[model samples]
Target: MTSSSKGSYTRLCIQVNLDKPLINTVKVGRLKQKVMYEGISFLCFYCGRLGHK
Candidate 1:
């Protein structure tokens, strides 16, 4: 957990399949956090494949 001026937060790393629908946010009880993709490359939204746009 990391603490800042606002509050403490936990960072999460989840592995997901590129073929499935992308998740935008995660909700736990009443707290919802936006999901951001990092270190992802060669993704084509048109076909949901890598390196063949």
Candidate 2:
């Protein structure tokens, strides 16, 4: 795992592999910000663009 520093946000990179047909993989990551936001943005490596709850 590795992390890149951004001015306002931090980009996290993780690696994993899948074992089952239905399951893709398992990834653990975190995003830390000074203030709370209304929307959620997750650029998933497997599924791609994930937003909101």
Candidate 3:
């Protein structure tokens, strides 16, 4: 797969491994917005914000 697709897949895997209630509350659009606005590498489910690691 392409690097972009691979990155998305990895993000999905990380999200799945996190607590259900954390990710369930926020809509996908909000997550995208957080990423866009903050220009971060990933959206953190636990803290509900964009972060880089």
Candidate 4:
């Protein structure tokens, strides 16, 4: 199997219209997973950031 250099097994990226509000969660099968950003140290604004949650 081959993989793209852009994403990981647990990660995905897509181009979206910036005019829309960001979605917090996405449905993965039956479970909902929160959307996350990378490279930040820590934060928790309803959603969590790395090293904080």
Maximum-lDDT candidate: 1
RMSD (CA, Å), each prediction: 4.3, 11.1, 12.3, 7.4
How do the residues 23-48 of candidate 4 rate in per-residue lDDT, one tens digit apiece? 67889899787877555455444453
Q: lDDT of all the models against the reference?
A: 0.69, 0.37, 0.41, 0.58
- The predicted structure with the larger lDDT, 1 or 4, is 1
lDDT (Cα, tens digit) per residue for candidate 1, span 1-53: 44655644656788778787566678979989876666768766556567753
TM-score for each candidate, following the candidate numbering: 0.50, 0.17, 0.22, 0.47
Runs in model 1 with CA error above 4 Å?
A: 1-9, 42-53
Clashes of each: 0, 0, 0, 0
The TM-score ranking, best first, is: 1, 4, 3, 2
lDDT of 2 by residue, 1-53 (tens): 33874365444443424231222333436633342223335534344334422
lDDT of 3 by residue, 6-51 (tens): 3332232243333332434334664632222233367565565545
lDDT comparing candidate 1 with the true structure: 0.69
> Which of the predicted structures, 3 or 4, would earn the higher TM-score when compared with the native?
4
CA shift at 19, candidate 1, in angstroms? Answer: 1.7
Best by TM-score: 1
Model 4 deviation from native, Cα RMSD in Å: 7.4
State model 4's lDDT: 0.58
Model 3 clash tally, residue pairs = 0
